[model samples]
Target: MKKQIMLAVSLALAGLSAPAFADGSGFIRVEAGRADVDIRADGIGNGSDDDTAFGVRGGYWFNPNIAVEGFYSRYYSASYNDGFDTYDVKLHGVGVGLVAKKNFGGNHTGFFVGGRAGVARGVATVEFDGSLEDAEASSAKPYFGVSAGYDFSETFGLSVNYDRLKSGGDGVDVTAETLTLGAELRF
Candidate 1:
């Protein structure tokens, strides 16, 4: 399933890399929103909830239609109890991606879609009736999403997008889906 999804995204990006007006924009962005997280484990009930999340992203557009971006996001902590022991989990991730976008309706308003392949780290701290146990897992993953925005001026704009992180290992599986609204400054 993961491979298929990655292949599909790659194909889509290759097909969409057509040249645009080519402006070479560079920017920094900060976003805040919510993340819905799901943690599944064997012999334990799933821990799934919504929590506050935020991210910072920076990118440099090589043209009006293409850019490379890097981002770091922090998600809210989730707690789980299954009649015996309780667990608390907090997840943070960083990644780099290629963003293919096009400017339309002038030079600053349009829609973009991109694919991301990166690594994520998961930290799980478990509590067993007065004792504490901690485990960490890291994995490389892939995700794809879309966004649309308009530049209020030549240097500022707002955008919203949905991003998902798929990660699993070391006795736990987690999927984080986040919707974020952000402000950006272009220079």
Candidate 2:
């Protein structure tokens, strides 16, 4: 599944590299941030933790105000310690979404605000510190985010974003919220 998503993103990026699409409509972004994860299990106490997170995204602007994007993200392992045992959780996902933005001056360079919505293939893994066995769960979930940024030039920009994502199955439920800083390069 992961491989398939990667291939799709790769193909989309290749398509973006074509000369016909090079009118500053294509972009790639790298993001780093912190993720807060909340976990709830059938019998165990609820747990919450924060960790480092990172992601990469590729997108194409259909116009000055709208675009489609594909992303891959990883939230580093987060650990929760109860009185007698410790649990570590890891999460990663791939998603495609739409972005709608308003540029301050009706151009690509300047302040911008945007909103995004999409669905992601979320995968969650939990490992126990003691004798309990490890478990993994995967599901598709809807995600949404808002972003604000300054475009220093038509080719470069910086942005801050907040996103919410979910993953769960069996007896465990996980919610992840991320605050990220992104650097973008447009071509």
Candidate 3:
């Protein structure tokens, strides 16, 4: 009974989405940015760290104004410096994101909003820089994100996004904000 209800709801949302963005153009984009992770507990290295990330993104249209997009994102190398210990982290993620947009007038520009769902993997390596004990942990977590974008031409656009990945592990919760520039093609 409950399972049937849940399936019905999923189908309804999916159906609602395609119609709102029934027509769309396809595109491919690449982005680069920085991220930080905040540790909310006492650990070997529990603080904010700076890291670099890059990714490839693409979208396909169902009609002239709606489409689906996915991104493969990876963090190069992230490390933190604490008085008691030094820590290292490696993070990788992939997601399928969908958005809908359309032009209100003959301005040749448009607006869009979409959601993304995906998985993330993290590898944390800790070393005692002072008197703290060393440790290591690996975790696989699920995440979701939302985004909005505008088209500058049939081939180019820009967008901003935010994501939350709450997989209960490693004594901390991790999340980040992402900004993107994109390009698209029309059939």
RMSD of each: 6.3, 3.7, 6.6
Q: Highest TM-score, which number?
A: 2
Tens-place lDDT digits, model 2, residues 1-187: 6577657757865776456454538889999999998888888879888889999999887767778898999975777899888998789888988889887954578899999997787889879998669989887788999999999887788999999989889888888899999998987
By lDDT, rank the candidates, best first.
2, 1, 3
lDDT of 1 at 38: 86
In model 3, the Cα lDDT at residue 170 comes to 56
* lDDT agreement of model 3 with the native: 0.56
Q: lDDT of each model, Cα atoms only? A: 0.69, 0.85, 0.56
Worst 10 residues of 1 by lDDT: 112-121
Query: What is the Cα-based TM-score of model 3?
Result: 0.57
Window of ten residues with lowest summed lDDT in model 2: 15-24
Query: Can you write out model 1's per-residue Cα lDDT over 1-187, one digit (the tens) per residue?
Result: 5466457646854665435314566789898999998888867868788999898988776665667677888876667787877776678777667776555646555443334444334333444445555666556676555776765676787778778887777767888888989887878
- Candidate 3 Cα errors over 4 Å, as ranges: 1-25, 40-45, 79-87, 105-108, 111-142, 167-172, 183-187
Tell me which of candidates 1 and 2 scores higher on TM-score. 2
Candidate 1 ranges with C-alpha deviation above 4 Å: 1-23, 78-87, 110-132
Cα error of candidate 1 at position 177, Å: 0.7
RMSD of candidate 3 to true structure, Å: 6.6
> Which of the two candidates, 1 or 3, achieves a greater lDDT against the reference?
1
